[model samples]
Target: MKVWKSVVSAALVSVLLAGCGSNAGTDNEQNEVKAGSTVNLKVFVAQPRLKEHYDKYIEQFKAKEKADKNIEVNVQLEMPPADNAPQILKTRLASNDAPDVFALHAVNEIPPFSKAGYLEDLSNQPFVDKLLDSVKPSVTDASGKVVAVPLETLSWGYLYNKDIFKEQGLEVPTTLTEMKAVVEKLKAAGITPFELSYKEAWVPQLFLPLTVGALTQTEHKDFVEKMNKDEASFSDMKALFDVFDLVNANGTDKALEVGADDGAAAYATGKAAMWIQGPWYAETILKSNPDVNFGVAPMPLNDNPDDTKINLSTSTSLAVSSSSKNKEVALDFVNYILDDKDSSAFYEALKFNPVAKVHTFKSFPWVDDALKYVNEGKAYQDPKIPQAVKDESGKALQGYYSGQLNQQQVIDALDKAWKSYNKVNK
Candidate 1:
């Protein structure tokens, strides 16, 4: 049988294969390999939600390796929550015990690692040609090399319960004024217009990206550049604060106490009409309430309908370790996952929109709608801002949500953080 077919078959029989006791070792024992032995490659993946799918793909990868190379391959799969993986991976890399392969965010996450000489350059790989041109910028490094295989493109917006909107006789809002009016109507009907989970600092900050994209579409195309150069401040973007105020004023009571999981559950159970998030929460929401019909749309940012645009970019990419003992095997495995015949299955398993040109995604109406922006080049991805600035921005947004910092204070804090970060990083 061909490798791809064998991989598909292995996926089917993965449960039985799970008991085979693959001899993959941990980072502590990675260097203790016997002479003339099977290859072992450790793969660190951050998507805890897709552990099963990754495990199945790894099994398929192993089966294919044995068939094609006549050498047994043991893949040690390390699964971690998205929130904690980067720090752990960083520690491991700094200690010279990096995994053979790992998943990382394309932009802000790649630079430090790549500059530190921890990532292998995959620019000339065949898989690089398969990626959607639109996503190439995010995965490309300062050296003009594609350092990773982009696995999925993600878009953030408002996930609204279509059923609730239809029953309430409300059209999906396309402008900020319309959105505020809809919120009032929903509130009048005793429904929470927006679900805010400010306890999870990142949740409240979701509004920023959509707001940023809308600003870029209207008047701030050089926003990221100016911010990086210290020539502009978040205060310059008053529209973002206006949108933040609209969302905070319309959120559920006790929203400051809600976490991401609780907020998702609330939206899933019809406790709220809207939740600002990306496609990452779709599975969780569907699992919570399979019958609830939902769709995603750009966050309406102003009175002009055309000003709204989705924030789209390569959300995850796979990269090989520069210091790996098994670089050849790692490269092969990365290529296998992205090959035309296998890429769709890998993406489908994660329920993510594919970044490869070989696949087509039509699963969700909101995803389809987001694709229209992508095709028309109406989407936006923030440039490579310093990690310190990114982290501080989240805190600033949370403070705004809690009224602990006024609008100007939040902007000042971010501007200060950005300047300080540039001094050190530059």
Candidate 2:
């Protein structure tokens, strides 16, 4: 889901007001508006790819609010790039100018914000009652408080072109050895085996965290704990490098230079037979080539078929600001979006899988397949590693892919980085 990076400017904030609506009254007046008066609630979101869906929901929610509570809901939408959103939101909250409502990652991203008391606790909110049982644990904190409403439960895996697989008589590989044979066949047939976009450091870093899940299942369930205690090191986890070698060997020669959009284009145009990504990229790929047929499977990280599993977690969630002047209205808006009727429309508009208990909605085949693993608890969430460690690990992987460092050197660097980060953060 780490797609783009762009600075959020003051000018962009000004533009968002025009996009939503004109400011009808003073900030204080708007905040203290009576039931019958028009009130504006600022909503900060990061998914630019789903802008149309958000726009539609804003209009729908406004109409519903006016009808139910006689208050005109003006939704000012501010969308920074996904990669820049977390820092921007943190800064805004710290400055006491937090958005009335905002989108955030459910796992690693939410803890610090919740600890700092920036998010409103929604544990007893009606929307929390509607969340699917499978998704409930993600939105709840360690203290069993529901801090955010689950938006989308996403899965990451290898996306393959069904048409190419069918035409070439290639079966979906469930093991690393099988995957290598498939890659060889694809390459022999003059098809790029994988679409790798390493220029976006976040993209390459994804596999590392995902591999942690597979490793936990097969080798060490307490790997993260041991690492934190300085009893374990990345050098001890050599299976990850083996998986990297397979991917790097089959990827496009210019992968290190390819950005996200370029990688999507290559895969959608049938230049590559597969791409490792999450369900978030499905819309973009389909938009690029409507005729392209694809399906998703867990990343085959090891030779044992049982060792591979999809990476699944709540990729995004919605929360109201604890300090919002219009907390009631903001909470109401959150409730409406998480409601079954409105939430279904929101997911349908964006073509995203629902995290709510909406049993009638049918997911894309790829998403449905990934959900099987999720239902069985075979999916993994990224460990709550520090952002600095994630950044360092990504750089190390880039070095490995670029032939600037050997596998052992990369592991040593990651272990060193982790120990240093732990000491500083502690």
Per-structure clash totals for the candidates: 0, 0
lDDT of 2 by residue, 1-426 (tens): 221212222223223223222221123222444778877799998877778878988898889888888898888999986546765876676556789999987876576566556677788888888888888888887678898887777777778899999989998888889998999899889988888888866677777777777778767778888887788887657888888888888887777788777788788999888887776877778888988988878888778776788877676888887777787788888888777676786776576777777534778888877778778776777666544455556667887787777887777766776676455334
In the range 227-284, model 1's lDDT, one tens digit per residue, is: 8688888776778777878888887877767777778788899988988877777777
Listed in order, each prediction's TM-score against the native is 0.84, 0.85
TM-score computed on alpha carbons, candidate 1:
0.84
Runs of candidate 2 exceeding 4 Å displacement? 1-33, 372-378, 403-409, 416-426
